[model samples]
Target: MGTFRDAMSYPLLRVGLIMLILALLISIAGFYRVNKTYSASGTLGEGMHYLGDDKFENEYLYHNRTLVLYSSNANLSLLQGAEMTNYTLVDREITLHPEERPVIYVFNGSVNYTYNATAVDYPYAVYSLFAFVLMLVGVVMAFLGYTQFLRDVKEGKK
Candidate 1:
């Protein structure tokens, strides 16, 4: 009991709290930017249309569903699922819901591609699910590091 309270007496705990809040704020910012209404500029290279193996066959669309990138604080991975109703002049932005997670489907006649997403009941793809778990681990590590630093300071016999 005394040790835990003593650990909280250091200033680093305050710093940790600030950092944790900052992380959450940054997460919210990212969530907002991605969920905004679709714009023409953002759509130009995001998706492409292609015909089946034979040009005369039916056409299919390929979307850039995901990208995994690292940031200063954490690794950020994005899986975008779009629902397109019309072929030309696409209308209504399609979003991949958490429930859909990862689905097996052919994109632009490519069978190797897969759909992986975040916040799903069941994660169908390995990479998509790994990223989310990574983020959660990072959060836990940050808290542990912060608290550890504070504990070390409070225990110093100065």
Candidate 2:
């Protein structure tokens, strides 16, 4: 349509379109990046052992038939050692797959045990949220730009 073509001549509209494209690409990357790993849930106090200070004052260990996990905190010993509290652990492939001693730890669930784990040095959900916000902003900006273009054309300023 002529109206669409005319609006495409607007500079702000072009910038907004570029922003939208970038946001889409970023969101796709985030989606695949998130799917590359998985999460596991379990009770904290079941089969966990207090390692009694290997590198820190409070260190613990958990293991199953397939994987081994070691968690440490300055105050981890304060919690009940064998209480039936729930927890979640992410896949080791996401944390440090290439290293000889890849770090494995438990995370958010029914327990307050905080594990400062990293996925390539950054959190995936936070970055994905930022990309989503960016996409929303881009959409709003594009709408505004199209409306401004229409107004300018109506006022014979285009």
The number of the candidate with the highest TM-score is 2
TM-score of 1: 0.25
lDDT of each candidate versus the true structure: 0.34, 0.46
Tens digit of per-residue lDDT, candidate 2, span 1-158: 23777888887787788789988887776644321122333334433333222332212122111222333321112223343333233332112222111122233322222223123222244567777888888888898888889888888877
TM-score versus the correct structure, for each prediction: 0.25, 0.41
**Clash number for candidate 1:** 2
Question: Stretches of candidate 1 above 4 Å error?
Answer: 3-6, 34-158
Clashes of each: 2, 0
Highest lDDT scorer: 2
